[model samples]
Target chain A: DTAVSQTPKYLVTQMGNDKSIKCEQNLGHDTMYWYKQDSKKFLKIMFSYNNKELIINETVPNRFSPKSPDKAHLNLHINSLELGDSAVYFCASSKTGWSSEKLFFGSGTQLSVL
Target chain B: AQSVTQLDSHVSVSEGTPVLLRCNYSSSYSPSLFWYVQHPNKGLQLLLKYTSAATLVKGINGFEAEFKKSETSFHLTKPSAHMSDAAEYFCVVSVGTGTASKLTFGTGTRLQVTL
Candidate 1:
């Protein structure tokens, strides 16, 4: 079974379009995270949720919103996406919210805004 | 504050040759360091980690890293490079110890191995 899975491996949309990326993990982990990799291949943390509660929210714009309906799933919703939003979004999970735990990542979703 | 720096943005080596990827980190507290490898279109995979345990940490795929507090460096090294080892490697540092703590990832280093 895939430990972490993200849908829509590739996304191409026009400017001002809204899109949603879904992520699910079957590792029975309590903490989940969303990371964005820019054109320079710099990965930055966007948001994190533990047990359906928001724990970490970086300086990402309001256009990027994350929702965790349950502990096993964390979804990202982008509103009025801009060209700058073109990058790879990754979903990751750990056993707990502990920083020391190793994160299991999913095959990322490549988002391209035209 | 915590941060990580990958010395090289790209490294080229021949198969069966020694491979080295340099990394430096800074943190206020005893930091947890990690090396993650990402293949094209794939997720990051854990190579090795240093958490104040043994300074020399060995990981999968014949990779290993040594943490040096004096220099604040945790460099990944391998005795022999394989073409399959070509990927992007990232150095990561955890600032704090709790669930709320954030991870700082270094600019990745792309490794290219030639036959």
Candidate 2:
């Protein structure tokens, strides 16, 4: 079975629009994370949730919000998306808390804001 | 602070040739090192990891890595190269002291296997 999956593999929207990307993991993991990869391919952590509890919130803008309905699902919602927000978003999960170094990442959602 | 550096940005090798990808890392405390591979338009896959266990680690696709603490290096090697091995490789380092350890990834190395 697919360990981790993300919806909306490609998203193209206009500026000032709002969008959401959903992620699910069946690895029975407790920690989930969202990372953004820019055009330069620099991967940066945006948010992390452990057991549906927020753990790490990076220096992302206030418009980007991460919601975890449960341990198996973590979704990202962006409000007033701008051109700079165009990038690939990846969702990952780990077995335990931050102590575990191995992470299973999803295919990623490519967002393009025109 | 923790960081990872990949020595080569791009490497090209012929089929059945030996492959080497060098990686160096620095950390304040006990660090966990990992090698991840990402195919075009795909997610990252864990090749191997070293976490205070055996210094020599073996992973899928006949890939292995050696961790030398004295040299502060974790270099990946393969006996033979395959066309399917063409992808981008990343070296990652993590220092988990609390409940929220974050990963720091290297710039990445692109491997090109030619026939």
List candidate 2 segments past 4 Å from native: none
TM-score of chain A of each: 0.99, 0.97
Candidate 1 CAPRI assessment class: high
lDDT of every predicted structure (CA atoms): 0.95, 0.93
Best by DockQ: 1
Tens digit per residue, CA lDDT, model 1, B94-115:
8665789778999999999998
lDDT of 1 by residue, A4-90 (tens): 999999999999999999999999999999999999999999999999999999999999999999999999999999999999999
> What would you estimate as the lDDT of candidate 2?
0.93
lDDT of 2 by residue, A3-108 (tens): 9999999999999999999999999999999999888777888998999999899999999999999999999999999999999999999987665468999999
lDDT of model 2 at residue A80? Answer: 100
How large is the interface RMSD of each prediction?
Answer: 0.9, 1.4
Evaluated at residue A53, the lDDT of candidate 2 is: 93
Candidate 1 regions with alpha-carbon error over 4 angstroms: none
Residue pairs with clashing backbones, model 2: none
